[model samples]
Target: MTFKGVHRLLLLVFMGLALAGCQTEDTPAKPQFVSTTSDSRNSNYFIEFRSRYALSYGHTYVVFGRTDGSGQMINPEVAGLHPKSTSAVPYVIGHFVPVPAETGWSDGDLEEPYRSASWRVMLSQAEYNKVVRKIRDLQANSKFWQAALYNCNAFTGDVARSMGYSVPPIQLRPQEFVTKLREMNEGRRSVSPSRVLTAS
Candidate 1:
């Protein structure tokens, strides 16, 4: 095959890999710690999108932090969206329309065995701050969650877009969402934020 043929074939491969995993979207235990803030070095800011198995479909979330000199993530913060109450009422209603949502760490966020996929990226201080700001805004203003609309994948996509990362379609499972994100941005090692963040 020619070079052009190879390129096109690779693109098709990735597209199929992503679409093949699509089907749906979990809940995890209460988190003991939150926020990527501590006596950590901000010289290197990083954000990681992760997925974990929960119930039938899995869950997606972001864990961001600074690394120590040894490159260990410190004070990792977790954020995501899910129904506010653990009861089946809100979650079931969320499938048809928006319902009360909670934007923070859920169960299995810190568990390795539960994680099915992860995509981590290093960001400039500017990009990191911008992403964090957007995360906060979404967390504060995102009062609803719906399986077909404002679910966990939607939440992570917002954060990714803030960092100028092209977001994949949202109607996918958590692991697929993260995988597609990494596949789509395989060339973007260091990217600028969508726009300069202004204080709000």
Candidate 2:
């Protein structure tokens, strides 16, 4: 009713709008996960921790898939037997690299994940989307991979951490990293072979 009262109300409205804008700017409002499908046969999913000895150091990667046998590797490399390899599976795979060679987190099938320890993880469509989003966010700026700093195993650990799993230290060797994930995955359903797949 009074001029001063009207002025005060206008100020409060301006402040509220400013705060709302800031909140929107600070938040990355991407879809809070992925497709919302509840198909029982397709909903059962798991994360596979894969590793292999390479040039004395070793390599590691992560694979996400369902247990309904819907995903399969097409022309999966037979390891040492192939000069080049790729997968035809619909699963999501993440790879971290070193400099001058596309270093950092990138999406693609790991060339022959020779030995692996895979464990089942129950995730709703939203949770799976969240995990994928986190991986992309973390890997986007991870361009420089250092021996003591960033590497494939480190990438794997970060993905696990993003998904609310306890991860081992990044310094662990590839085999140790897989073992640690397997240990943490204890009691969870597994879609991988009971025996670790070793290179023949």
Give all TM-scores, in the order shown: 0.73, 0.51
lDDT (Cα, tens digit) per residue for candidate 1, span 1-200: 99999988866665554344354443342222212222213456878888888774778899987867775788999999989986888876666557888999887787887978876665567667877888899999989887765788989999887766788888777877787777676454234532232111
lDDT of each: 0.71, 0.44
Cα deviation of 99, candidate 2, in Å: 3.5
Lowest lDDT block of 10, candidate 2 = 76-85
lDDT of 1 at 5: 100
lDDT of 1: 0.71
Estimate, for each residue in 44-64, the C-alpha lDDT of model 2 and write its tens digit: 544455555543334566656
Q: Any residue pairs clashing in model 2, and if so which?
A: 74-88
Sliding window of 10 residues with minimal summed lDDT for model 1? 31-40
